[model samples]
Target: MELWYTEKHTDSVKFSIQVDRQLYSGQSEFQRIDVFDSKEFGRFLTLDGYMMLTEKDEFIYHEMMVHVPMAVHPAVKRVLIIGGGDGGAIRELVRYPTVEHIDLVEIDELVVEVCKKHLPQTACCFNDPRVHLHFEDGLRYIRHCEDEYDLIIVDSTDPFGPGEGLFTKEFYGNCYKALKADGIMVNQHESAFYADDAIAMQRAHKRIVQSFLISKVYQAHIPTYPSGHWLFGFASKKYHPTADLNGVKWNALGLKTRYYNTRLHAGCFALPNYVEEMLRDAE
Candidate 1:
């Protein structure tokens, strides 16, 4: 008998992975958490029956989320990550020795604990001195902050459940207040391939556009995610993702990344016509 793990991407579409064994399974106060080992993707994590990350392609998401903004903004000393409980974003962030402090606000404490125990590959950087963990509501956390961070990464789950509040216009407005004059906020904009995800992506972009001086969308391909095409939202008060990117300065850091490079950074923003149309309609 084969043990298969499946998730519904849409009403009629589903994705499945053949699992060697179920490493761990538990329910948190917020959502269900499961870890499974597979022949292809190594160890993977899921929340509420949704695929969060797989070992094989987690690098792409984490690197793009961290490096793109880091390349654009010159001095990103203080950073705030909202809802990245798995620690993949933190792992990529701690690489920047110049980054002085990191505040990670995760709503689910169980997500952090489970990821640390089962997915150490991405969870390894939690103990770094620069990382300060706060298990609280990200929405509430940002409301209390004003001009505090140079970079804010909203590595949230889908725009529902605990993450629904993060997508609202009010939340984007608060994020603007939480950042310095030149701060940049990058978030997990959902996929454009499916109708439900595309609607969510458009709504998120529309709200961010209303709040920030600069708003843009970028793409990446993560096989485990819906349709293998995922998007990230880049909103800033000053810096433009491509125009302000200092490739020479970023390359000088000599950070070896598997998916993100200065060249790819520019290319990712070149969206498809349909995606552009959707964003325009939302605007």
Candidate 2:
């Protein structure tokens, strides 16, 4: 039997996926974790009925999540990733030679285990020595952390369950505190097509803007996610994103990438007028 992955964007519109198989589905301490193998996306990861990642386009999400901020801040040496148990984000993060350490704070251990066992391609970064796996609440971890990291990426799931607090003002304040004075943070913001989630995105925008000197939203296309479009929030204390690529090499290792390129990097920041309007009206 074929299972379908569906996210109700609205009472009138919904984004759905047709899958070949359901690999895993159950309730964790926080929410439901569902893994599905799809004909188009290869494999799909879902949390609390919301689609998170898909095989065919996972690189787009992971690459933009890691590279955009890293490119802007060439001095990034230490990094923190919150709730990216699939390791896709880490896969992209470890590509930077300047990075000395990476602390991964994920609430659910099973998400890591499942991805490792079933989705090796996505879970490959778990073996990197630079990565420190911490199976703990991300908010709590960030709260106690001082000015330690150069970059912090909130690779969380949707903002409705265990991931809800991740989008809160308190958490944004903690993220601001956890980073160095010149540090930057990138978070997985929701899509603008979903009215309720779009509203949530507005609130997140406000919170980050209040906490950081530079706050901007970038866009990308992720078909697995609701609305087939996604946004990422970048907030920094001192540095603006375009400051300098003075002596930097974009893909130093020649690490093969599918979606992210220097051209696409700049293009992602070019938001449509409608998206800008949503953000403006949000303010």
Best by lDDT: 1
- The clash number for model 1 is 0
Tens-digit per-residue lDDT, 1-283, candidate 1: 9999999999999999999999989988898899999999999999887899999999999999999999999999999999999999999999999999999999999999999999999999999999999999999999999999999999998988889999999999999999999999998999898999999999999999999989999999888999999999999999999999999999999999999999999999999999999999998
Deviation (Å) of 205 in candidate 1: 0.5
Mark the regions of model 1 whose C-alpha exceeds 4 Å error after superposition.
none
Task: Give the per-residue lDDT digits (tens) of candidate 2, residues 1-283.
Answer: 6677777777887787787889998788877888988787798888877777787888889998988888788689999999999999998888777799999999999899888987887899888899999999998999999899999999988777888889898999999999998899999989887788799889899888878888889999987677878999989988776554322476564666788777777778889898899988766
lDDT of 2 at 211: 88
Clashing pairs in 2: none
Residue 84 shift from truth in candidate 1, angstroms: 0.6
